[model samples]
Target: MNAQTDHASTVSGRQVARAALWLDLLHRQFPELIEELAPGRTGAPGRSAPPPDAAASARRSAADRADRDAALWNEQHGLRGAGGGSAPLRLHVSDALRDITDGVVELEEAIRDRLGLGRPPRADVPARLRRIAGLLASVADHPVLAEHVLAECRRMSRRCSAALGEAEQLVRVRGRCPWCDSVSLRAFPAWRAVLCVNPGCRCTEADCECRTSPGHRHTWAETSWSQLALDAGVDESELAVLVEAAEPADGSGSVSGSESVGGSGSAA
Candidate 1:
């Protein structure tokens, strides 16, 4: 192949790999998502529950307060009855999963048509994902078509991730933000940055010249995380804990903010 063709092939191969990897991850995480959405059950016999730490207790309290607030708001706004509870949230999750499944099926049909392939066999989401990955691999030689397919794959992967509760997994930082002096610092592992989530913080404007931008924000990149720890008077060990907490619970590789369908998109 010519040099141009070689470059196109390389790009297409990389995109295909990334798209397939995301789909595979979603397939693996599907069971965990279902378990989380399902009602909690009693601990198994001979297996004791771990005692809640102070942090865990505090988190539970905060969550309870938030739930109560949500219930009050819903009741006042006629969004739900007096004691609606978490049923509505569960319904939304179900609808989101259904939509993602439908999109995947449609994409499968589209790809089969583009590749002059026959209808796919009736299968579950995991099986469909495997089939889609195989179809994407077949199209890698045609760069333009591969690009479109890869874009669709990325879009579906992102939707699947969000529906499965894998996106926006923010970890709270222990100390105040060094730049903003706000206690709203959070580590966004996908972006590999720690930032203040407070809206009124001026850190972004101080760093950049986008003073007039309404939603401007700033982050301390991985390179500067150590500096942030020092500035915030957080110990190195504590900083390490924050990093560990930011990692995916399943130990899967994080999908970086830059890897979305559009090159300029942010996963955060």
Candidate 2:
């Protein structure tokens, strides 16, 4: 990635900071993702690009996206009813998704730095980061934090899938090594690749489990995009868009603002 990612610092604090940034990033990327995956297929190729094939393509996309979410959800958590559903669910899901997205971004960037896959966070976002960080720090003691984290993660299972795909492509071109894109590694059986949600670890391979705990800062355990779809109720195609929308950039870079990442996915 880039050198600007190091600014997140090595600690739980980075999760919070990155969460905020990533939430903003998702909003910014959502439109692009929707356009890319569904993008309204050209229906008869007429004056106005026909009617745009929204029927068949949309269903296929939804299923594909859902499958991606199931993969992520399967590994780290089970499933929950948003613990509130709809109104409250959306609020919580939205908040948690934003945080988790940012935190994951931070963790990914941090891990990249460890494995030399990317650069460190920069100090430019300090002012805005502090605002979102304050919210996470304020609720540090709430029992719901973990639930919120998981819920947030669960909600993002789909987005995470898209991100993994993008990351996978990057890995493909650069290399699939969980570490930096420096080395090449293949997946096992039906799996394609893995992604790390932690920031300080060293993992050069797809199944790497290295984390900040040991000196191995770049390694990490990444579930496949297929896992997320397996767990969540979201359509596979829609879920795919979520994954794309949620993918973090090379560095800890994000749309803007940030909060702490979730300890678990919403399914937890």
> Top TM-score: which candidate number?
1
Q: Summing lDDT over every window of 10 consecutive residues in candidate 1, give the lowest-scoring window.
A: 258-267
Q: Which tens-of-lDDT digit does each residue in 68-113 have in candidate 1?
A: 6776677678676443466445544566677767877887887787
Q: What are the Cα lDDT values of the candidates?
A: 0.64, 0.38
- Candidates in order, TM-scores: namely 0.50, 0.27
CA deviation > 4 Å runs, candidate 2: 1-11, 36-137, 141-268
The TM-score obtained by model 2 is 0.27
lDDT of 2 by residue, 68-118 (tens): 455446434755343332232233334444554466556434434444445
Candidate 1's error at 66, in angstroms? 20
Q: What is the C-alpha RMSD of each candidate to the true structure, in Å?
A: 13.4, 19.1
Worst ten-residue run, lDDT, model 2?
Answer: 259-268
Q: Over 4 Å off in model 1, which ranges?
A: 41-84, 167-198, 201-253, 256-268
